[model samples]
Target chain A: MNLIVAILSGAVVYAVSVLYAGIGETFTERSGVMNLGVEGIMLMGAMSGCVTAFHTRNLALAMLIVILTGAVLGLIFAFLTVTLQSDQTVCGMAMLILGTGLSGFLGEDIASKPINLKFTKIPLPVLSEIPIIGDILFNQNLLVYIMYLLLPLATFYIYKTRWGLKLRALGENPAVLDAAGENVFAMRYGYIVFGTTMMAISGAFVSLAQTNVWQEGMTAGKGWIAFALVAFSSWNPATLALGALLFGFISNLGSNLQIYLPGVPTEIFSAMPYVATIVVLIISTGNFRKKHTAEPAALAKAYDRESR
Target chain B: MSAMNKFRFEKREKQSALRTLIITAVSVLLALVCCGILIFSVGSKPLKVYETMLTQVFLSPTGIKNMLRSSLPLMFCGLGVALTFKMNLNNIGAEGQYAAGVIAGGAFVLFGPDIEGVPGMIITALCCFLGGAIWALICAIPKAYWGVNESITTLMMNYIALMILAYLCLGPWKMPRQNTGMTERIPRSMDIPEIMIGDIQISVGVFIGIIVAALIYCAYKYTTGGYQLTVISKSPKSAQYAGISIKKNILMVMSLSGGLAGLAGFMQYAGVAHRIVENMPNNAGYTAIVIAYLSRLNPFTVVVVSILFGGLQNSTAYVQSLGVPSQIATMMQGVIMIFVIAGDFFQRYRLVIAKEGKA
Candidate 1:
């Protein structure tokens, strides 16, 4: 593979992992529930996938385990923040800790060890042969292919449909949605679960598709980056997709550059993605020059039926 | 809804002090029970593990010293986090800020002039504080000025700070003739002294933590600046209406928070390790968040909770020999936090089952 194509292809592979979680968080924040436990949840999903693969050696079972783990966690989180009406930020932090702690405890035995299972790349027919573009985007795992459809489908789902409209309204004003005979609590619960399950898929991608190994807290700060990207892209799925790819390319560019410059400490390049997230977060949200943000008004606020 | 079982939660107008204490105590007890189950699941008898942990963490002289010794970083980090949290600024980057403090403090000890004893220690401490404050301000300025989410930005900065620390430890500052990832030890003149009380040794740094906590307590209870923080936390719009400078306070509180977290590095360096090392704070920064929240942002309570929580964190080392994973400490913190959050909700509201048909 040519160097440029390789980087682009690598970028796609990298972008898919975070994009799944990013888009998931987009849906979550859009529904007025901001989950800060993305890192923890991602770790748990990754751990569950690794454990299942090691024990069962069935990729299907591993994937199912990941989803089940995410569903259970997502339900607990929704119960705490939505039904219990706890502080979303604090609860989110607790969830993050809970996920990280649980995963770390459970996955301790597998640290630095191989799971002996991987999602092998399957290039699509004809599409994988289209000069440069095909190889860059088409030659990837099944999960990467799903992203191609997910991006547009999610954008259309949130913007073009009544359910999407209601989701947006739920974030902006749950009281208004409640007045319109909508099940505000149930809708929030549904989105929260869906978002968390998507985060699990993101984690499974890392363990089962990308690395094929289990490392404690191996998702690192990608979950945090996804959380920030929610605000960075101004809550637009299309823009968020582009931003994630840009991250993919820039982050890959660092490793590519390392081949030419060997004297600089490797940690600097490692820090690039995180530093970039901070910079991008500032650029997109910093209202510099009076740019408007499409933020959901009732975000992170608990809604009570009697209050309205 | 069935009339016989119909119930609703009603918020209390005021939560009494006794209720607050009861809620906290019950939550902690519940968390311990959950952790006991966790230990049992790992194949060890929960009773034996708890007995070992309780004795090792609190009973022995060395255990008492270690508990207070390990609590040093938590004291500073918890105080730091407690302050920013009071103003609703989620400065989760204290872990990174603590690293920045170590890096800066190390740089000074390696290159700066040698001054022995107390003044030198004070200067080094100040340097560490400045390092942490500067690291925190990176997120604070953007948050205060541009509405950037402080929580995410602070978190992202943790990786950045760790990278810089790793860069130094591996590249320029790597100790000569040693494979370990750390800088050289500080001069003996700069080391914080430990006084022996019978079989135990307590570093003066712990006193410094207590003093700092007391100072923060006074500021929070009596100062106009602290009053402004409460106003902003309650409602930014109302704070603005009342002419409180939210931006200035955000910058101030976050810097202080970061600086205090940075002081944790100083504790590890001068008081404990006497050398700058990688993973220095060891997640005391995150544990501090749980401590701060559980302590209810009270400085005096923060001191007490830091020791208890720090004991929980450090005591895992004792149980690792008994088939319990060291990560149990981290899990315990999470469990306790969840319980506390749930317990707080109960304290604020009560479910009243109403019999509408009978009435």
Candidate 2:
């Protein structure tokens, strides 16, 4: 039962983190831009959040700092890829290196230092009584509940709102939005900042909730999984949540199996998340091929309004 | 001056070549400044550190040899990456392929007889090359057939390779009766022989790397295959209309690229490290990617760039001797890569004020 509790705790945190990343990526992709810098953006957030938390020992303030730092990194990426019309791949790759270097260098002294936040956990008195489901859902950190709330909010924001429509329109055909007299760059920038901020929060969640101390390269390949989940869910927020949960489950399974199945090669088990990501990417791409649907027409293209 | 001449002032046409050169120069300058700041922050004189780094890499004979030795794997990995980039394929799996090559080469060393003379070395080299190419082909084939994103595939493969390497080090391949998680020393018979010139000992691996670079340069400069790849990269649609098979080309180039990286692993075992160890390439795979891009994916230029970076890597220990953390060097590499990439914006586009009615 305690093992189950441990597994559940890990899964909840993992799901929330991945959800933040996936939702953020969906926003960027909707603006007809692919920010491969999710990993980098996450690093920035993790560092900013961890450093703040380490010194102040305040979890809430640390979260705020991480979100703000994410916004700045996102804006920089947006300015480069959207405003400057640079290659998205190169920009993303550059940002990845920059983020990793910055975080590792800045966070070097405090990487393993313990600074517990004593994060608040929420539980329903009656709901917590239910056996399996109660432990899984009713008893989790406030962030987990917040993630659950944001899942629907994100879905509504993308599917129902006028701004969401405009964002999607850019992905499909920026010329249409341009013809409609919308400032495509500004619109894309808005989404990029929003998305980048979300990614940072996701990174911060790991440090603030799951563990108190920050480690170098701690995000591992979670950023990539978030990127992959965007496609796995076919860019739908609801589906994205499901995809993230599934990924979290796989991750949980890998770690859980580490103790139960001691005879198994832990190395192979350690590779589960990345392998699952590759499998998801391949499978999702295969589905796309089967459906014969094209990605957003303007995806990965930098629009130069003056070129014509 | 006539009124017509006065009004007909010619606008300067953007010189693409000049733009590229200027951006590269600016990026390099920025990188140096960043390194300078980092060194200064560490309470050391940046100039002194750089001098030590340079003198150790270029001025001393032993230093030059070490630089060349360190450069061997980088040369192969850089060239491999360059070849893939030339074809517009992102093969980020060189690190994985190198790991696989080590596994294959190590197996031969541990399992096969310590055959004497050049035959042993030749067989080992062939095995390593084939090992890398075969390992690389796994990803290439899936990417070609399934439309799988090679970037993710290659990146994931790196983890898988790392795990496999870990398993080998810790499991059945673990050194017999040894506490350390390393294979037994490879017999000297299976190793590449060191050459002596006067008082200097030159490893044959460096010679092989230089020869490979020369060969790659020739291929890129003169061969039809190279021209085909160049054409494909510039405009894939045109190549297809011209009857070139994109799938076949992708597979072929990726395999060749992987094979080159594998050869690095082979040489490392045969000439340099002489045994399979943990993190053998260290960050060489990633560093090679940066070097390949800095050289604009030109095979010949890649050779020059590799040496420059290899020198930096060789001088890292020397830089540490200056009381600065050697990790600063890695940070410098990352910073340089960022500036190099961001510098592309200035090369491809120029800022201009909006003309009348353009907005």
Candidate 3:
């Protein structure tokens, strides 16, 4: 029963974090920009959330502030890449370094000082008692629950809405969107800012609500995993959620199995998520090649109106 | 095609070189400004910190040796990273490859066939190179056959490799009865012998690095494979049409790249640390990437750039002696990378201010 609960909990956290980052990345990629800076942005957000919560002890406000901080940085990245037309890779890399360096420097100050910030936990009153399944699924933090709600809403918004249609069109061919009475640059900018903000919030969720402590390099490779999950899911928000859950399970399983399999060499188990990512990537891309799975056509390739 | 036309061509050449020089100067100045900001934050004079850093790296023979020793691995890693990068392949797994080398080299020292009073150093170094190259092949294989993105795959492999090293150091390979999470020291026979000229502790690794740099330069400039990579990077379709095998080149480039990084890994262990420990190589792979990119992927340039960065890093220890944080140098290194990437803009594209009528 405990093992089942652990698996469910692991899946939920993984799904939520992946969902947030995946949705946001989808928005950016859809607009013909790839934010390789996702990890860095998330790092900064994690630091901001931890530090804010440490000083103010207001978990809710800290979360809000961290998300907003992500939005602001995302806007800066968009401004450089979209407005100034800087090399997306270079700007993205710069944003990453800037985010990482600033956060690490700030984390030094936040460490050693304990805060009474609470980790997010289950809030459903009766649903928590349902069974082995309900106990695991329904008993996560309010923040994670919000992520569950956001996932379907994001899917609907991306696939159903007029704005979503314009966003996809912009990614496919910015000139067509520009000709069809929509501001291509503006839409791209909006998506980048919005996507990076969510990515940041996802990272902050780990530091503020999950761990409730500011650990240096604590996000580890979670950001990169989120980035890989985007590809594994093939640009679908819902499928990405599934992929994230799978990764989360892999990650949590390693930690949990430490006790059960003490002699198995903990480091080998620690490599599970990464090894899994590579395997998944190989499988997915291989499948794509085999079946001729059509990519978004303009994924990561910038569309220039004048050039076109 | 007259005399005036020739003068115009000469003028253009002078102007472009002048522009490059100015941009480089500004970037260095920006880096210094960042350093100054750090000094101020740490409650020290910027000039004093700079002076101490310079004196520490160049004035002291020990510091020079240390810098060269640190730079030896970087030289290889930088060249390897720069080589793949020229083909538009971002092989960020040099860190993993480096770690893999240490693990592979460590095996030789710990368990390799012991020949009668043999030079263990040569055997261990060869093992390090082979280990790094083989580990790099793991990343190369998938990229070659499976169409996998090498960047993320390599980066992910870094974590796995680090974990493996951690497991061995802390568990099965633990030095018997040691308090720390480190393997037992390799035998001194496996150590890279140092050449002492007065107070300097320069190892044979530096000499090897120079030779390797020269060889890599020759390979890139004169070899068909190097030319093929450059052509493929510019236009893969054209290369394919011209009958160059993409998969073969990818494998060869990645293997060679990994081999270089692996050698750096071995050098770090046999020359510097003398044992595989957690955090061995200490972000050297990552920083080497920055150096490689900054040098614009030229093998010869990688050597010059690595030495410069190495000097800056060496000076940091001196600056730290002034009661300031050692992390200040790392911050500076990060800032320099940003500027370096930004500098590429000036090289490739010229900024033009549009007039009011342009819109």
Ten residues in sequence with the least summed lDDT for candidate 1 chain B: B1-10
**Compared with the true structure, what per-residue lDDT tens digits does model 3 show for residues B49-122?**
88777777866787788888878778889988888888877788888888888888888777878731236776
Which is superior by lDDT, 1 or 2?
Answer: 1
The residue-by-residue lDDT of candidate 2 on B1-359, one tens digit each, is 24333332232366576678788989988988887886787588989988887787767778877776777788889889888878767787788888888888778877987775578777777777777888788778778887777876787777788779878987888888877667877778767666877766677876777788788878867998877777899999999999888888899999888888888887777777877887787767767777788888877677777767777877878877677654564567777877776777666655555444443
Off by over 4 Å in 2: A1-9, A118-120, A124-126, A287-291, B1-19, B38-48, B57-59, B177-179, B190-202, B321-326, B350-359
Clashing pairs in 2: none
Error of 3 at A94 (Å): 3.8
Interface RMSD of 2: 2.3
| Candidate 1 deviant stretches above 4 angstroms | B197-199
Q: Against the unseen true structure, what C-alpha lDDT does each candidate score?
A: 0.88, 0.79, 0.77
Summed backbone clashes in each candidate are 0, 0, 0
Question: lDDT tens digits, residues B1-359, model 1?
Answer: 56535777878888798899998999999988998897787687888888898898878888888888889898899999999998888988889999999988888888888775788889889899999999999999999898888998899888888888877887788899988788888888778888998888887888888899999888877999878888898899999999999999999999999999889988988988888876687888888899999989988889888888767877889989988877888888898898898888888798787777643
DockQ of 3: 0.43
Docking class of 3: acceptable
Model 1 clashing residue pairs (backbone): none
Superior by TM-score: candidate 2 or candidate 3: 3
How high is the DockQ of candidate 1? 0.79
lDDT of 3 at B212: 82
